[model samples]
Target: MAAPAGDNVQLTDGEERAISSYFGFDCLYDHQRKVISDTLLSKDVFLSTKTSSGKSLCYQSIPVVYQHRQLPVIVLVISPLLSIMEEQVHLLRAMGFTATVIGKDPKENNDIKTGKYSFLYTNPETVLKDDEWREVLMTEVYRKTVRLIVVDEAHTVTQWGTSSTEEVFREWFGRLGELRSLLPGIPMLAITATATNINRRKIKQKLCMMNSIDYTESPDRNNISLFVSEIPHAKPLEEVFGWLVTAAKQNSCPRTVVFCKSIGDTAKVYGMFVRELAGCHREIVNMYHSCTLPNIKEKIRANMNDIDGSLQILICTNAAGMGVDFKGVQSVVNYGPPQELDTLIQQLGRAGRDGSQSLHILFYKNNK
Candidate 1:
C-alpha cells in the first residue's frame, strides 16, 4: 500500500509509507490527509465529520508519523467511553504499535514514566484527578515528547460537560479548559461524529481553541431511510413489540438494534422478545445497558459484529450505542424520541455503516 502521488507534502516519506502500510490504503481521504497535514504543521483542528468517516485516522496518524521519525513522541487521547478507549488500544496493539489504556495498574505508571508507550488512552476524570498520572504528564519526558492531544466525542464537552443536571460530568469534563494552560503549544484535535453550529462553537470555547481549524460535513446518511410514527398511548409497548418482530423476521433486514430510553425499558423489551419470538428470533435477541456486566457487554459487542452469529437483535439504552461500531446493523428502532436531535443522529449513524441500504424507525406516543 503506497501513498498516492501528490499527497500532502507535510508528511515525510517515512510517515507516508507508515500510514499507507498501517491502514492498507493507497491514499487517505481528502479530509484525512488535510487533518494530518495541518496537525503536523502544529495547528489546532476540530473535525465534525459523519460516523465511519475515518475521523480516528486524522489523529491516529500523528503518533505513527512521529514514530517514523524515530522520536519518542506520545499522543494522548481523551475518550469518554471505556469501551471505545479499550477498542482503540487493542487495534493499535494489533497493528504492532505500543498503546495502553490508563488504569490503576502500577505497570501503566512505569510504562508512562519510562516513555515506553507511543499512545495513551484515558478519560478526562482519570487525567484530571489521578495524582500519579498527572505527575507522569508533568515529567520532562512527557513534556518533551508528547506531540498531540485528541478529544474524541468532543460534542460531550457541551452535551454532558455542562449539563445542569449531571453534576458528575460537569465536575470532570469542566477541567478540559485547564488543558490549554497546562500544555500551551501542543496541537489539540477535537473530533465528533455529530455537532450543530452551536455545539461547534461551544466545544471550541470550552476546550479553549479559539484559533482551531474547523472541518464539517453534513450528518445525513443517504442510505438510511427514516420513518416516524405515533403509537396510541395505551398500546405503545404492543406496537413496538410488533414492529420489532416484523423487522427481524424480514429477510432483507436481518440485523437490528432497538434503542430505549432506560435500562428498565430495555429489559422489558428484551424479555418480551424472548417470550414472544419463540424460535430463531428469540435466540438472537439480547439486552444491553450500563448495568450489563463488562464481560457480557464485550461478548454482546462481539456477537453483534459477527455477521453470521445468532445474535441478530439488541435492545439497549443509549450507552450501548456510543462509539461502538457494529457494521452489520441493518435497522435501528428508536422506542421513543431521542433526548435531543444530535443523539438521534448518532444512534441512527450506527446502522448502515457498511454503506448498504438501512432503515431507521422512530416511534412516539401520540399526545392526543
Candidate 2:
C-alpha cells in the first residue's frame, strides 16, 4: 500500500474531492467513504473501526476542503495520553502541516490565538486546567475561522460525564454546547476505536450533537490468537513474572507488552521484570505506568519507539493501549483480565500489527 498523500491531498469543489483523489485512492473503503461523505454533509458522526482502519483519515480529510476555502480550519482532537498527542504532533509536523498542543507545557504562554494551528490535540485534563482555551474558541476571532471540532477517544469524555466533579462536568458540557452554539452548523466529529452503547449515547447527548450517525467495525483482530490461564489466586504478580520469562524464551527477540489493570499492577510487573530479567538481553525492556514523572515518561516513550527486538517488553497499565501505535509488537500479555472487553481488545490490537503470527495471553491466579 502506498503512503497516504501529504496534506497536499487535493480537495474538490474547494470543499471535498470527487470521492477519489482526496484519499489518495481510486476509491474509498466502503466505511471510509461513508464517514467522509457524512461529515462533509454537516452531520455529527461517531465511528468505531478496527485497528489501522483509517479512522483518522476520515476527519483529517475534512480539514483539506475547509482549508482550501480559506475558511481557516481548526480541528480539535481530544486524546487522554499526553505521549500519544505528542506523537501525533510529530507526525503532522513531519508531513509539513501546522499542528499544536496546548497545556502540555505551562510555560507556553503564547497567545491562544485562533487560526494559529490547523489541528489541535489536547486531553480533558488539559482542557480543564486551561479555561482560556475554550474562551479562545468561543471568541469572535475563532468562531469565524474554526470549521470543525473532533473528539478523539470520545469515551473518556463520557466517563467524565458521571464523574465526581459535577461542577467540572457541567462546565465541560456547557462549554461543548456553547461551542456548538458558537459554531452553529460547523461539523463535529467524534472518533473512537472502542465504545460501549451506553457510553456512545452519552457522548452524543453530552456533546450536544443532533442526528449523529454511528459507524463501527469490531475491534477483534482474528489474526491474533487468545489464551487464558488461571493459577493460584495468591501471587498473581509472581505468576505474571514467570510467564514473561517463559514467553521471552519462546520467540527470537519478540517485542512484547504486558498490561496490568492499575498503576500499582504496572509497578509490580515492572519491578519483577527489572529485578528478575535485568541484563538478560541487549534490547531494552522498560515500564510505562502513569505515575512516572513527566520527564521520565517522555524518555520511556522515546526509548520504546527506538528499540527493536522480541525481548523488548513494555509493562504498563491501560494508559499505553489507546491510539499509541507500536509497530511489530509481537506479543501482548495481560497480567490479569482487564475491566472490560474493549480494553482487552485495544491492548491486543497493538500486537500482530505487522501481520506476523502474534500471541495474546491472560494470566490469573487460580482460586480453586
Candidate 3:
C-alpha cells in the first residue's frame, strides 16, 4: 500500500471495518488509509517507513478486504528469509487469517493449490526457480484470483543486486523482477524500513515498479535514544565488556542484540560472554550468522520472541536482524560503525519495536 497515484483513494465502509476489526485498532493512520485505498485500485506501492510502523497491516489488509466481500483473492508475499515467512505466517494464523509458507510445510501444498490460503509466503528462489511453483503460478486459478504480489524487505533487491557477494552466495535476490512476467498485471507492494532516494530508485528499477506510488515517512522512533562512543582497543578485553559481564552476573542485563560486522566477531564476543558467565552461557547468550544451522536458528528465533525465555543476549552479524519482529529487544549494540548508513538505521530500528523505551549504543574504534 502507498500514497494514491489515482483519484478517489477512499475506503468503503465494509473495507474500513474489515481492517480495524481484524487488526484491533481504533483507527488507521493517514498513511495506512492512503495505502489501503490505493491498493484497492490495484496500484503499485513502495512503502518506506520505520520498523514497527504497522507496515505489515498495509498489505495484510488487502486480502482481508477481498475476503470480506466474499472474493476469492490471494496475496503472494516474497520475503528474504524463511524465518521471516514462518514467523509472519504463524502470527497471521493466530490473527485468524489463512496464510502459509509453500515449502517445508508439505501438508499445506495441496491446500495452497486449492487456493485455501489467502496469503502464500515464499522466498525469491522459489519464485524464480522452482518448477512446481512455476506451474502453480501458470494455473488459471492463480492467474484469475491472485490479485497482488508483495515484496517484503524489498531494499534487499537493490542491496544484493550490485553486490558481488550475491553472485557467489545467492543471486536470486537480484533476479526478483522476473516475477513480473510470471504474474503479469498484478500490482506489487514493496515494503522496507531502510531505503534512501538512491536505494529507492534502484529498488524500483529492480522490481520494475517505475510507476509505483510512494509513501515515505520519517524514519524516526521516538522511544529510541542513540549514542555513539569510541572504544579504546588497546585496553584489555575485560575492561571493555566488564560492565556487561557484571550486569549478566546479576541477571539484570536488558534483552539486547549486539551487531558485529563479521561472523568471527560474533563468535569471539559470544565466547567472551560464555567464559565470563561460567557454565550458564547456554542459558544466557547465543550467536547467529549465515552459517548457523537451521534448527538452531529456529530455536534462537523462538527464544528471542519469548520475553521470559532463558536466552537474552544475542551477538550476530547481519543475518538475524532483517525483517522478523522479535518480542522485546530493549537494547541494540553495534560493535562498530557500519560502512553503510542503511545498515545502521536497520540495525537500530530493531529496538523499541515492542513500544518500550530502548537504547541504541554504537561503539567504534579509531583508525589511527
Candidate 4:
C-alpha cells in the first residue's frame, strides 16, 4: 500500500497513469482520483459522487494495483438494489471484465465457488444469510482471492436502520471483526452518491471501518435542467396526465419515466397508463415496479429496450430506476417527490446516461 507523499494530497504519478490507462480517460475527476489513490494506500473511503460519475472506478482500479501479485479471489461489491447489481454486472461485462453476480443468476453460484471471476457483486443481506457462502468467504481461498470489499449504496444500510437478522447486519453490526480475523488487513471501501453528516458517521461505525475519508463531487449538471412544482393537495395522477400531454406535444420525441413514490402509487400510475394512455388516449406505454410479478417486470424491462419505438412511455417507481438502462430517455417525471434529494438525483440520472439533453420535473403538493 502506498502513502501520499508530503503535505500534498494529489495522486502520485503512478496512480494517475494507471487510472487513465484502465478507464481510457485522460484524468479522473478530482474526487474519483483522490478516492482511488487513497484506497490504494489501504484506507477505507466513504464517498458521495453522483451516479455515472465513475465511482466504481475507485475499487475497479484498486484491484488492478493492490491484488498483492495474486489474482483476487474476487472483489466483493455489496449493492443495495437488484437493479444496481444487474446494471453493474452488465456494464462490467461490457468492459470485458470477468464479473459474476452472486445474488441473481443462480447458475453462477457454482461459478462463484470455482473462483473463476475477477469480481463478485452481491447484496450484504445475501452475503450473511448463506452460511455455506460465509464459510467459503472466511476461508484462505477467499482470503487470498478477495483483495477489497466494496459497499455500494452504503447509506442505505445505515439510514434504513439495521436489520435484526444477523445475516443482514453481519457486515455492518461489528461482525467485520470476526471476518477480519480470518482475512487480516484487507481494505474496505464504502461508496454512496449521497450521505448526510449522520449517515457518514453511522456508515463508519456500522462497517467497523476506521480512518475513513469521504469524497463528494458537486451535484451540478450543466446539461441537465431541473424543475420543481409544489402544489397543495395535488393529485399525483393529474400531474402525470399533464406531463404526458405536454411531452407528447413537444417538438422532439422524448422518452419519459414517471416515478411514483410508493407501490400503491405505482398501481395508480400503471392504471393511468392503461386507461389514460392505452385505452381512451391510445398511447403506447408500459408499467413496472417491485410489486409487479417477476415475469411481468422482465417483460416491461424488455419492452423498454425496443429500439424501433415499440415502447415509448415507461411508468415506474424507484424500484425500476436503480441500474436499469433506458437509453434515450429524455425526460423523467416525478409523480411524487422523492424522500431525499440524493434518491431524486439517482432516479433522474437514468434519463441522461446517454449525455443528451435530459429533463427532470418534480410534482409535489403540500397537504398542510
Find the candidate with the highest TM-score and give its number.
1
Writing each residue's lDDT as its tens digit, candidate 2 over 103-200 gives: 65655535446467777787654554466775665666556655557887666665544565455443353245455754566667888777777767
lDDT of each: 0.81, 0.68, 0.83, 0.68
Between prediction 1 and prediction 2, the one with superior lDDT is 1
Q: How high is the lDDT of residue 295 in model 1? A: 97
TM-scores for every candidate against the unseen true structure: 0.93, 0.83, 0.92, 0.80
Please tell me which model should have the higher TM-score, number 1 or number 2. Answer: 1
User: Which tens-of-lDDT digit does each residue in 1-368 have in candidate 1?
Assistant: 11112222377666777898887989788899888988777678999999899999888887678667666678889888888888888889998888988883665777767778888988877877877667777666776777788999887788777876656544667568776655557778999988999888988998988999999999999999999988787884656577567766664346889999988888888888887777766667889998989999888887876778678888999887778888588889899887778888999899999999999999888778
Q: Per-residue lDDT for 1-368 in model 4, tens only?
A: 22212212334777577657876988777777777667655567788777668777887775455333333436788776766676677778887678977846678777787777888887655666667777767766666667668887776666454655444433443343244554456667888767767767876887777677877766666667999887667555656376575445452347778898988877777776566554434445777877778777766776666555556677787778665667677788887788667678778877776677888888877779
- Model 4 clashes, total count: 4
Candidate 4 lDDT (Cα, whole model)? 0.68
- Give per-candidate clash totals: 0, 8, 0, 4
Candidate 4 — which residues are off by over 4 angstroms? 1-23, 66-73, 103-111, 163-183, 232-240, 249-253, 279-283, 299-309, 354-356
Question: Model 4: what TM-score?
Answer: 0.80
Which candidate's lDDT is highest? 3
Scored by Cα lDDT, where does model 1 land? Answer: 0.81
Please give the lDDT score for candidate 3: 0.83
User: Poorest 10 consecutive residues of model 2 by lDDT?
Assistant: 1-10
